[model samples]
Target chain A: MSTGGHKGATAAGRLSVLVGALSVPAFVGLWELIARSRIVNAVLFPPPSTVAVAVLDWIQSGQFFGDLSASLFRVTVGFLIGTAGGIMLGVLTGRFRLVSSLLSPLFHILRPIPPIAFVPIVILWFGLSETGKLFLVVWGVFFTVWLATHIGVQKVDRGLVRAALMLGTPRRQMLSEIILLGALPYIVVGLRTAVSISFYTLVAAELAGAFAGIVYRIEIAQQNMQTGQVMGGLAALGLLSFVADRSFAAIAERAVWWR
Target chain B: MVAMMHNPLRPTPPLRLVDAPPEPSSTAPEAIIRVENLSIVFDVPRGEVIAVDRVSLAVMPGEFVSLVGPSGCGKSTLLNAMAGLERPFEGEVIVAGKPMLAPRPDIGMVFQQPHLFPWKSVRRNIAHGPRALGKSKTEALRIADDLIEMIGLTKFASAYPHTLSGGMQQRVAIARALANQPRELLMDEPFGALDAQTRAVMQDNLLELRDRINATIVFVTHDIDEAILLSDRVLIMSAGPGRILRDLSVGLPRPRSSAILTDPAYLALKRDCLDLIRTEGRKAFEQMEAVT
Candidate 1:
């Protein structure tokens, strides 16, 4: 009786795995069929085949590489700069009451205003340049990383701090080692959230004005009424963000290496 | 033999005098730690609460002393004052003839929880103290390696704190505390979190370790048996708003082991400690009930 139950459970597990594998492909096949049929307007909601063709043409046109690199550069460089600034300021505010008193109130007020809302003012200040686009992404990423680091630093174990103190650890070493490492798990969590926020703000930035980017191409395609290219651009953006999040998740797992 | 004398199956004769007579006052000048009318208070929402109440004691150099009391009795608070982790509301703690206002490299402490650096391996965690004192990496690691071997954790030197068992992690904490070779070692219920079997084993390990280190030791615990087993002198503390009730010196022979637990002299000493604590515990309980 137990053997039969075990066999039944294994069969169910295998069936679930098979179903999960087919889930995305099945959805795509159904969408293709529905588009090919007269059920929806193919021009507006182009079939998967049309979208695939457009993506292939994009790659052949060689503009795709330029567009991809531009978008990648904005996200990567902006994320790095924002993360560095956030961590630095966060450590300062988190560790020192004087620093926190001076900055935390201002950050709290500015933090509530969405980075997307800054697009208009950013355009005024930097005027459709790469700097303007970079500002928006940095603005979006900074607050998340900062808040996470601030809270993380504050929540560091008092016991660890006491233990370090009793061991004769100096003030500087205490912050750099015990306090910083203790709060790292929280900082990594903040960094992961910032990854997605960087992409979201990239949309707002590129929409504001951009000479070249994935979102820029999508806007140009929309103007020309090339629905297939527009869909392709959306797909490319989704794939890029998905890859970024997954890779970061992998990196984050190792970031708290002790666990 | 000695093991036979400690056998539970046999009824051993009670020794007439288990307690040692008070030592001469001339030893005071050589005292490693001197707590003079020390008190600590905590401000709760309603009002301030006294944790330590004018507690005064002296521990001579190379002495192993235990502060034994019930939970919330502020025994740990008193020990913290000695470690410079707690400030006295009045009076002060003087170690090595100097007042302790901040933690110094000459003093080390092991808390109830190991508080080992989760990110660092056993070796690196032990090496932290030396490195923080500006020792070179090579010298610090060498110190760490020697201490790891002493703690019998050489096999797991590179393993992180979370990967080790609770007992193993605590052993590493002891090694880390010893890394700086402090003149004094303060342990606040270091084995309080371990299970009975592990606690017993750790007690034995500490007994063996004590003979080898030259530092004066101040330990804290609520367990009467633990206090008597490891300490040269056990200072029994009264419940809340803690004050020392009795200072009992254990004269039981060392090279002590768990076997001494059943010895007649040891049992007599433990009984006296238990009776005093029981009376104090009852009094504290009644006082709380009256207030409520």
Candidate 2:
């Protein structure tokens, strides 16, 4: 009876895999049919083919690489700086009661304010320069990583700390080796979440006003009513964010090497 | 005959005292670790609670002492105080004539759990103590390798803590503690979490290991059998507001094994310990009932 049940379960699993493989293509085909059938105006609701052509033209124009690089640079640089700062402060506040007492309340007040809400003040301070865009992304990424690392450090096992203490571990080595590694699992989780957050804030940053970026191009295309280009830009942004999240997950799995 | 003592089925020999009873105050110059009028208090939600109250004891160098008590009797607290992990509410803990305010390299400890660094392999975990004490990487690794071999974990030297069984991990913890060559080693129920069979094996392993190292050891456990099986002296403690109730000299023969568990003299000592603990348990229970 168990063997029969196992065979049935295997068959269902294979069927699900087959269906999952066809899911995206089936949706795209149905949408293409609807757009071409005149059920929706093709000019406004362009099919995949129209969006593909628009993307091809975008590449041909040579502006695609420029926009891609600008967006990628902001996300990458902002993420690195924010993550570094977050981890440093998190360790301090988490380990020392005095530091936490001084900083935690202030950070708590500032953290909940969305990155998008900072656009008007950031524009006033830095104008339409790249600094403002970087600021927005960094602002979004920093709080998440900081909060995660802070809680992670605090949650480090007391028994491990005691064991390390009795072994004559110096203060610096205790923090760097035992406490830091103990918190790495939490830090990795925070960093992966920040990957998607960086992209989200990138949209807000570019839309605030950028000379070159995917979001900027999308905004320009929207103003011109080039719906196909706008749709293509959205697809590109979604694909980029998806890839970033997946790659980060892969890196995160290896960061805690022991697990 | 001397060979007859090794016979498992033979009638056990009389208890052989290792020495005369230690003086009441134990003010000898050779005492390595000393706790004088130590009190540890905790501020719980209800009110202040005394974990340990005016507990004074001295351990001679190279002595194997075990603090045995019921749970919450503060035996582990006393051990931690000696390790410098706990600040005394009053009085002081002195090691080698120096007061213990913070952990020093001369002292090492093994907690109940393995408490191994999950990120490091068995060799690296053992190497951590030496490395932290400012030893060179090569020197530290050499020390770790020697300890790994000593603990019979040479095969698992490269294995991570999570990959090893509980007993194996704990063996590494002990080796790690010993890696520093501490003058004194403090163990708080190091084998408490293991299974019956595993705990027995660990006890035997510890007995064998003890003969090879010369460090003074102070072990804490609630298990009376474990205390008697391992120590030269057993200090029994009372429950909450913990106080040392009795000091026993285990005058059993040396190079001992689990076979001593069946010895008649050993049973007599165990009976006395059980009676003291049971009387104390009942008094504590009655006191709680009165308060409620």
Candidate 3:
């Protein structure tokens, strides 16, 4: 008998999209209801519409763009460093057992220590400045991407390696072509995860004894009793994260199609 | 045929030649692949196991040779040693009139799995060896295009390995191997993974291809019929400390077919090979059972 199971899949997919489309409005509506009821004090938990207006005012006034740029610039720098180092190290270790043994211990020791855990230490070391923030972001992105790359390289096809050997490919070309191409699916996974880490580390970096960032702006809004401004800043961070994740996901999908 | 007549088959005739009259090259000096008392040993927990025991052979330039034996006969090992992937404990393998100490572009190899890079298109895979061999990028690309067409994959040059069938994939591997224009080709059960029908068809395609190209080929297989069908001469090896049991020349006319498999001469050749292997293989198996 025919399974006819595709009907359930189609219905589930439709429902999933509908739920995603409704999330923002549902969140905004709930906030308004809660504010009117004075459940947590409108000053403490501002209505979503209030936050929306504050966000619009910030963008129109161009105050939001500067903070956004500064945070993004920091993330961009740290992300590049982390990703480059990770890929290089990953490949080196994957190809050579000697490199793997020498470097694996360092990776294990560093991986479990949360990048945010370095915030206080980083402040002491880099003096609560951009350097401190950059350091935090770099550490955060590096280990995650590194782990992904290393695993990817390790997982490459043994048959492909042997084939390359038989076909007269030199060791260098084997690395650049066969091994590198083999690790592409791993790189995609690493890149997608690294983008999330970049965003995550950026927030942590900003919050760690910082000023003039989105996180700092929210903190200031709280102290000033500007409930709407605080809500606006928080929502801005969430939107940025959502957009980045979606974009990375789209790119990953395209890459996998070709890869 | 002058260029390739000194093929590995030249030295290794099958069981029929065990008592044949001695020939001139049987004492002649120069050989392409000179295996002298080559032995290969494997490390086991209890002790050491020897795969090849002081076996020696030679292949001349431009010859089409087949190393045919039952499973675990060390034919592939001998092939690998010649390719310089493995070192013999007791002897040496000289290739192209030089000691083959390591792998090089001069010696091409085809494995059972097509081993085509899944991410790359057929054209890219075919050109891989040439590129790695330091040919100019433009030259490599041109050569790759020519080879893709040669392999009858011109229309499918842009297709990835996953999109191709097993036979097509192996064709790509073969194209890739020959891209470097190697002096000789070492094939380890190249068609062993394909179905019987596909294998038969591929065997013919390969023979046709061989007629066009003059590269010496050392083909390894467990199939007696395939060995007879493809080779100019078949070297049947004995198992359990593999050594050449018989080196017989297949005198059947080329452009052969499945019908040839039933020919009395071919059948007799197969029977002789089976006779040697059947005893050796059974003895090896019984020995293993005794140990267990």
Candidate 4:
């Protein structure tokens, strides 16, 4: 009886795997049929074939590479700068009450205000340049990483700190090694959240004003009423952010090496 | 030290044991740790609570002393004072003729939990102490390798703390403490978290380790048998504004093992300790009852 149940369970598992594999293809096929059938206006909601053709044409066009690199550069450089600043400040505020008292209140107020809300002020401050776009992405990523590291540092095991103190761990080593490494798990978690936030803010940044980017191309395509190109741009953005999040997750797993 | 009297309300056991001996006076070598009238107070929400009340004791160089008491008796608090991890509300703890205001490299401590660095391997964890004290990487790692071998964890030297068993992790903690070659080792129930079998093995390991290291050791535990088994002197403490009740000396010969747990002399000493602790435990219980 148990063997029969086990066999049935394996069969169900295999069926679920097959179903999952077909899920996206099935949805696309249905959307294609519905669009061609005129259930929806094809111009507004282009069929999968049209979108695929537009994406292929985009790759063939020399402008695609420029757009892709521009978007990638802003995200990568902005993420790195924001992450660095966040971790440095997080360690300071987390370790020192004086530093925390001076900065935490200000950060709390600024953190809740959406980064996109700063678009008008950022343009005024830095104009419609790369700096403003970078600032928006950095603003979005910084608070998340900072809060995670701050909480992580505070939550470090008291027992470990006491043990380190007993071992005569010098003050500097205590902060760099024990305190920092102890809080790394939390920091990594914050960093992962920041990855997605960086992409979200990129949308706002590129929408505000950009010479070249995936979102910029989408806006240009919308102006020309090229629905297929617009849909293709959206897909590209989704795929990029999805890849970023997954790759970061893999990196994060290794970051907390002990775990 | 105050001696405990047998309870007249209950019939006495057949064991005929000598009363606790008087505290040893100052002799040739000066004490390595001298806790003078130390008291620690903690502020709770309602009011302040006295954890240790005017506790004074001295541990001689190379002496193995155990502070035995019930839970919340402040024996650990007193031990923390010696480690400079706790501040005295009044008086002070002097180690090596200097008041202990902060933890010094020359003094080491092992806590109930292993508290090993989860990110570091056994070797790196042990090396942390030496490296923190400004030793070069090579010298620190060499010290770590030696201590790892001493702790019989050479096979698992590169294993992280979370990967090891509780007993193995604690062995690494001990090695880490010894990495600095501290003049004084303070252990707050180092084996209390282990199972009975593991704890027994650790006690034997500690006994063997003690003979080789020349450091003065101060151990804290609530287990009477454990206290008597490992210590040259066992100081019994009473709870409720914790105070020392008796100081008993174990005159058992060295090169001892779990085999001594059955010896007649050992049994007699154990009985006396149990009797005193049982009475004190009752008094503490009654006092708590009255408070509520």
Span of ten consecutive residues with least summed lDDT in model 1 chain A: A1-10
Ranking by DockQ: 4, 2, 1, 3
A best-first ranking of the candidates according to their TM-score comes to 2, 4, 1, 3
**Tens digit of per-residue lDDT, candidate 1, span B1-292:** 0010222553544465768543322326568798877889999999999999988799999999999988889999999989988888887788987888888888999999999989899999999999999999999999999999999999999999999999999999999999999989999999999999999999999999999998899999999889998999999999999999999999998889888889999999999999999999998999899999
TM-score of each: 0.92, 0.94, 0.89, 0.93
List residue ranges in candidate 2 displaced over 4 A.
A1-6, B1-26
Tens-digit lDDT track of model 4 for A111-133: 99999999999989988899999
Q: What C-alpha lDDT, on a 0 to 100 scale, does residue B228 get in candidate 4?
A: 84
Model 3 Cα lDDT, one tens digit per residue, B215-264: 99999998888888888888888876789988888899877767798899
Judge the docking of candidate 2 as incorrect, acceptable, medium or high: medium
Report the C-alpha lDDT of model 2 over B90-204, residue by residue, as the tens digit. 8788898787888887898999999999999999999999999899999999999999999899899999999999999999999999999998999999999999999999999
| Best prediction by TM-score | 2
lDDT of 1 by residue, A161-239 (tens): 9989988889988888888888899999999999999999999999997989999999999999999999999999999
Relative to the true structure, how large is the alpha-carbon lDDT of every model? 0.91, 0.91, 0.82, 0.91
Please identify model 4 stretches exceeding 4 Å from their true place. A1-5, B1-29
Clashing pairs in 3: B4-B62, B4-B63, B6-B60, B7-B63, B13-B247, B13-B248, B14-B246, B14-B247, B14-B248
Clash pairs of candidate 1?
A: none
lDDT of 4 by residue, B1-292 (tens): 2222233554444454777433222331377788767788999999999999988788889999999988889999999989999987887788887788888889999999999999999999999999999999999999999999999998999999998999999999999999999999999999999999999999999999999988999999998888888989999999768899898999999888999999999999999988988898898899899989
